[model samples]
Target: MESGMFEDEFQNDGSFLHDEFEDGENFEDTENETSDATDDPKRQGWLVQIRNLNGEVTERRMWAKQVPKLPVTEQIIVPFKGNQPVGTDIDGLLGQYLGRLASNHKLLPISFKKWPEVVKTYKDWVWEKHIKWEPIHEAAARTSFMMDMGKKWRENRIRLFHTKFDQTLSREENIRNPPLSIPPTEWAAFIDYRLEEDTTKKSKQNAANRAKLTINHTGGSKKLKRRSEEIMSQIGKPVSRGTLYIETHKRRDGSYINEEARQVCEKIAEIESQGTVPVEVAIDDSLGQVKGAEHYGRVRAI
Candidate 1:
């Protein structure tokens, strides 16, 4: 289930999840800059303007009725209220976009060890290029951006180590013939780090812990946030978190991860199939609230 458990890809390495933060580093100003020249220049700081988040975009969508027959595949850009989203979450489209850049190694830090500096550099790069995404609160945006970039960076590092480290060749040979992208010195350091005694010990412990779980999910690499957005756009309606879980946690042969998962999905599905949802929470009026949502309207799996 989406909330009940995390995807195994994210939980693969303890080192990636927990890294030592570089101290006393100066962070660049991550304020959301105005893309529109018409915007008041006086208001160019931490607090940015917002919109009406009172109801769902669907209900507020004047074109919903007029465009009912539109192809489901046709992409629609729904403008959400609260221009500056509350709290700190990097799981939105903005984060996903930046995360893609991170995965591609386009978004990089000055040094892997200088965590704060990396966040600063990343913020500068994004703000300069993406004025359209200039409404998220600075703290929230930077924290999420840094984390997403860091995770992807670490994962990519490990992937490179696995794919490039040659078993047939000696360590010196491998280090000398570094990848075109990586610097010779950095590559050598990385190789040495991987072969270090403490690093190997920690990796073994993490692997042992990961092996404790018997049931790995069938869902691929897509995060639930993106998956839910796609579903909502396709159906032209919101779906419950439980329903989302049932959709994702199923096997290729139309079976569930386990018997317990089957039971939960069945129960949640039954509830969703019923028309017991209130009129106020209609697809057009309100974003269909996930059946049992918690924490800033996010849903949890049973």
Candidate 2:
């Protein structure tokens, strides 16, 4: 009887009751297989929670039976214009937030430094835009005096007691016995003095040399002799021999043999007779002896 009952239970179905039993067993096996799949060790579960300003709680949970791996530096929350909270350091809040996110995900932080130069540049720009040009006291005084005189001339009337007019009166008073105190002239002299103060030593030397040359070349007949004496005095000391030769011959005139040229020529002939050209003649071909008619043509008529 027990064998007969086991045969009935394992029989290949020809009855509705047998078929129902087989289908139910298969469904149970499928449910067990799905439960085993959910028990995988690599699967993950995560939860996120947030509390609103009004104390409302929100929660979210997720299960991953076969989730893929994420990148090492993934960001959890992206900032949006309407949702981002204000930070204490507003100037670098975005950078700080990015750095924090990078740190949480094991990434490098972006570099940041104080830009003091930007503030300084903006300040300089503002100053240049609005600042007025202020003249010095002397310049202001001169400008005001000139402006007042211009106004008076425009009105076609003279003010006897204007400050500038009074200053002029005082100048006349000093000019009689004491020194004159003309402010305009004094201002001009002051400007000249300032200019002179800025002149270099080389410039002063050149001016003195020019004055000496000028005086040497003046006064007609005796000018050549004076120029020759001046040249000799300057040679090897104040002036080079080449410079002296050039300056002496610069104005040959072709009318008369000047004493300066005669002296230079005699010196050149003596040096050449000694079998050596003078240092001056060697430096410049023009300073060498003029040949043929050109030489005698320059000699003065006896």
Q: State model 1's lDDT.
A: 0.45
Error of 1 at 268 (Å): 5.3
Residue range 1-302, candidate 1, lDDT tens digits: 00011112231210101111123322221112222111356532222111222311121121111222223232223222222222112123333344444543334532254335455656566544431222323344445555665666666666677788897999899989987666688778778877789877987898898998654555454556556655676789765555567778797688989886676667757666675653233332112343243457543431
Clashing pairs in 2: none
| Alpha-carbon lDDT of model 2 | 0.27
Model 1 Cα shift for residue 101 (angstroms)? 3.0
Candidate 2 has what TM-score?
0.17
**In TM-score terms, which candidate is top?**
1
Q: In terms of lDDT, which candidate is strongest?
A: 1
lDDT measured at residue 139 in model 2 versus the true structure, 0 to 100: 36
Q: What would the TM-score be for candidate 1 when compared with the true structure?
A: 0.52
- Candidate 2 runs further than 4 Å off: 1-196, 200-205, 214-258, 277-302
